[model samples]
Target: MLCVEFFAILFLAYVILSLSFERFLVSRVKELYKSLIPTTSYINSINQAEDIDILTSNLQKLNSEKNLEIELLKKEQDYRREFIGNLAHELKTPLFTVQGYVLTLQDGVKDKKVVKKYLKQTSKGVDRLIYIIKDLDLITKFESGIASLDRKSFDIVEVVRNVFELLEMRASKDKIVLKFDKEYSKQLMVFADKDRIQQVLTNLIINSLKYGTERGVTEVSIEILKENKILIRIADNGEGIDEQHLPRLFERFYRVDKTRSRNQGGSGLGLAIVKHIIEAHDEKIFVESKVRIGSEFSFSLTLNQD
Candidate 1:
């Protein structure tokens, strides 16, 4: 009996020792898991901080770009205002001269021929002043998006013919031959503001006439492409625009020959008006010229398919 009791006691002691060891091992595993959780949380927080920093950097870059754009816009606005002020000042001189001449004549400068000469010059100056003011007004309206187009469908040929007829007197006086090459069909129609389109054509034709060689020919041509657009080209045989000036030809108050242009009564705003008018119709205008050879001003307008 004592031997059996001793064996039972040994078995009980072994079980108790095993249970204590298992409890200690479980406690150690829990402590290890608890410690790892804080490390994982710390790593996640660091990654979040890095991401936030990167986002802040991107935002700052975007802000810098925006600020730069704002500054550019402001500068452009200032330049435009200054340009207009200068143009106004420039225009005022001739206007005041004409006014002074008229006043002098009114104050009894009696030679009829002398008076007539002054009157003619004054009249020319007045006309030039009127032209500049009109062009400036039109540009302002266009830039402000306040210019309304009178959209209509018209035969492109008819418009061309009309413009040709209107400028015939001037062309004849200049001894310049004006011709039209009818490459397109007679019934080609275009969708655009008729008056504005006519204005563009007039400006182009007059520009050609102004710069065309003495007694040289100026040609107007119409070409219809399969791309559903109509091209009108005004070409002149004259001293063509320089490569450097070509890009800025459509800018307001740009002059290739300032003195000659002024003497010829050019306000340097005609081409600019033409450009804006063409663009306002969602069309495009371009120019190509070779020095001493000639220049061709071409513009494309949407065609009426029907």
Candidate 2:
């Protein structure tokens, strides 16, 4: 009988001790949480029962959000670094070429043929430099909201015809023909910035002409997509862009064939400008390409119902 009583007392003592330890641990955890987030409204809402699980879950959530923000900031930093590097490289090439030509002229090697060649090369370099600077300035204006669209009703087909006339000589030089997929009604009108849209058409056609195979064809077509939207597509039958290059094709100074791009003598800002102009009108642009086939550039514009 006495051993049974003693055993019961010991069991009671053990139970009390366990409860005390549990209470102590919970209290310490609450204090730690308060220290970590003393001013948090979440702490104030916590009950005295002090569920550690709740606090832990909230902490984990906050931590995850902070980590995500940090990652985004890192990506943005990397992009800016790459952009600055590309800009410097593009500008440096033309500047150095012009400098070299000037030095050659200064060396007193004044054969008429040599002088004419040097002068012509120098002029081309200057023109490329001017184009790059102007394009950069234009993009900055677009981003800063200083460049605005003067929206008006204009015939898109007429715009395409004008662009063809403007680029006819260059296209002919490459034996690349520009044509429409079908005869469209001349009254098809779009609501957009006419001059900006013209610029976009000119850029895409010029790009097609530059990279197209000899005697290739570039066709422009229009489709009425919806009640208020129309899609304009420019497709080429020359060398198509690789899939990987399609994404960055509209980026500034990005060239699929870097050597060919340089030899082609362009400032490499044309597509980028085209992208900005279309986006300024709140429209989207898209590209489709296949290796050894051809590429197409398309954009949507609001229809002018009036």
Candidate 3:
């Protein structure tokens, strides 16, 4: 009987110890599961943060590209507007002139004098059209960067003299005195395209004549600056340009007085061409004007020391 009781007590103690150990293991497993849940949540949050960052960067880049495209589109639109405006103005002049002459001829006034006058007017219109087309072609070539300059070293004074001689007839007809004051030596040479320089000079001189007062003296002076550049000034005592009109002087087809410009036989491209030619030579042009006081147009080009 005693042996039996002792064995039963030992069995009971082993069963209690095993049950307590099982409960402890269950609690430990629950704690480990709770910790794992928080760790998994933290990992998901980190992934979401990375995704947000990536999306933000992409959005910024896309916005930047969109702005750039908008700017390019705006510039293209502006260019188109300017081109169309110039074209219409250019076409309108010759068309109007031709229409006027044709209508006059159709008026049953077939006198020889009337016919001759109409024919001359028609010819002038055609010539103006041709000039406009030529200038437009030149401007297109210049803007497209395909125009080549016939670069050579030549005496600038000689070129100026040639321009004066070439346009002397027109100046004489207009009674505009064309004079050149040599502030530098007669042997001053500049490296540039001879024809282009002559074109620029002629255009400036003609412009001076067109706007100048009757019997007004137009002066062309060349000065050597300390910066090793040469300044060529074309000054005229014309019905001076308005302060507001000065800024747009170099713009294509821009005219201070439209009717007057037309009457004076300007295509409004002369100054623009001058601007481009000077720029091609890596030079700059400037203008100073006072209303009714006269205007001075000047350009500077680097001297060819070599």
Candidate 4:
């Protein structure tokens, strides 16, 4: 009986030790959990904040890019609308004129004077239409690289003299004087497509005459800009182009004067064509003008080296 009692006491002591150890272990676990929780939460919060900032930045950048694209598309749309409207207006004017003259002739108005007058008027309208179409075609060819340059060496002074002589009657009619800055008796040889250069000069001189003040002077001058390039200038003491019109001077079909007299005006493609021809030669062109003071159109050309 004593042995049984000792065994029972040893069993009780073992149970108490096991219970105490379990309580101590549970307390240690709870403390460790409390210590690690704030650090884990803080790290998680930092990671989340960084992720949100990046997402917001990316979203804002995307929105800005989208807005820019939308603005560009709107501009293009507006430009296209304006272009179409101008084109239709330009073509319709001469067409209507021609049609009216034809209908008048067809109505059997039989006087020879009337008939001749209508015929001439109709002919002028047709010529204007033709000029517009031809100029448009030439610009297309230039833009497409289909118009090849025929470079030849020629005396620029002789070319200018020819232009002066050709327009002598026209200039005299307006009482306008056409002259070179000085007598270029010596050869001013340039390498370019002679015909195209002549055309450029004709367009510029004619433009000056058309818009020039009555009895104004249109002058051509040359300067040796560098060893390889010469500057050719066509300047006029006439009503000058406005500042706003200067930026788009070379745009096709652009007109400075909305009510400019068509009788004395051109196809409105002269300056655009001039720009294309000059650019094709890998050259530069510039315009300087002021209201009333005058206008000067200058371009550089390569000197003939051979």
Best by TM-score: 2
Candidate 4 lDDT, 20-41, residue by residue in tens: 8765654554444345453443
As for candidate 4, its clashing pairs are: none
- Deviating ranges (above 4 Å) for candidate 4: 1-67
Cα lDDT of model 2 by residue, 1-306, tens digit: 999999999999999998787777767766787787687666655554447688678778978998999999999999899889988988898899999998999988758999999989999889888988999999889878899899999999999999999999999999999999998766788899999999999999999998899999999999989769999999998789898888788887789988888888775688889999999999999999987799999999999987
Prediction 1 TM-score vs. true: 0.77
Candidate 2 Cα outliers beyond 4 Å, as residue runs: 1-39, 47-49, 266-268
lDDT of all predictions: 0.83, 0.88, 0.83, 0.85
Q: Which 10-residue window of candidate 1 scores lowest in summed lDDT?
A: 41-50
lDDT of 2 at 166: 93
Clashes of 2: 0
lDDT of 3: 0.83
Model 3: per-residue Cα lDDT over 1-306, one tens digit each: 999999999999998887777656545543543454444432233322234454456447857998999999999999899889878978897989998998888886658997998889999888888888999999889989999998888888888888889889989998988888645455777888989988998888888888888888889998889867899999999888888988889988889999888777776899999999999988999999887778899998767787
Query: How accurate locally is residue 73 in candidate 1, as Cα lDDT from 0 to 100?
Result: 100
Q: Name the Cα RMSD for model 2.
A: 3.6
